[model samples]
Target: MSTRQYGTFVVIGSGSGIGNHVAYTFAVKGFSHIIPLARNDWTYNRVCFFNAARIVLGGLLESVETIEENFETTNIALYIVAQWAIPRLRALSASSAAAKSSLLVTNSLLYANPIPQLFSLSLVKAAQCSLVMSLAKTFNSSGIHIALVTVGGAVAPEKLESKKYC
Candidate 1:
């Protein structure tokens, strides 16, 4: 496969599972800026190339200088790190032409179907889908591309309260 050249993109929900894998993928190569934003403290390195790479961790910006100091705010390139935050981040980043951002998300297949066990998640997914459609329609002029990926059962969670879910 061929790789495209671009600057840093932020990874949300990046901790121990698929999110961490994607963050490490970006950190390995392609981009120089890899911002690993995770609510959890888990970090997984899938490749050796990221062994010595610099990964920045920040939850949110409290001050302008805070982001400047940590992520070099001069370059405003970014990407949403979470599945649900993907559209919001895409819109925020694409609100300006300088942001130069793109969104790549991994949504679950159940997002389209209804599951009794994951009923709450289904509602969230429905809302997320509507937001994605709205954002795509509103932000196409800002040079931001939205890539939707609905996938499931590929990478299971490593740490679970009960093994039955696995």
Candidate 2:
């Protein structure tokens, strides 16, 4: 991919996991400003990438409070950030033909293959996928590209044997 050196890149949940890796990759790719928000931070921008999520492990046995908290962290948080980022991205795209603005949200296969042991997480992921699709439909015609990065499993360093597939 060609690097763009002028836009701001924001990654939520950048303290760890996929968020951390994305932030690092964009920085290396020459984004002029890179904002890294931890799971609790609300600081908002361009190329807005949402990866803030919590894994709740109790399934149907999980307390209501726990499930609610999971939704707050994962789904609600993305909505909040999207509300802040979308218009700015739209404006940016309109102002410059060279501008590339996008909203990218990390998702999981749990939304499709529901796991009983992670019921709350599964529910929230489903909600998130729906939200991302809606955003894409609403914004794509205006030049802002909205997408979901649905990860099928945990992200980890590739084992040596996996390199052969590459």
Best by TM-score: 2
Q: Per-prediction count of colliding residue pairs?
A: 1, 0
lDDT string, candidate 1, 1-166, tens digits: 1146668878877766776566555544467676766553232221111111112333332344443442321112222233344555455554554454555433456457756554444444455555555656776565555545565543333432122211
Query: Any idea what lDDT model 2 has?
Result: 0.79
Cα RMSD of predicted structure 2: 10.2
Model 1, stretches more than 4 Å misplaced? 1-33, 36-100, 157-166
RMSD to the hidden true structure, all candidates: 16.4, 10.2
TM-scores for the candidates: 0.38, 0.69
CA error at residue 29 for candidate 2, angstroms: 17
What's the lDDT for all of these models? 0.46, 0.79
- What's model 1's TM-score? 0.38
lDDT of 2 by residue, 13-77 (tens): 77556776676666555676677776442222347888778875786778989888988999889
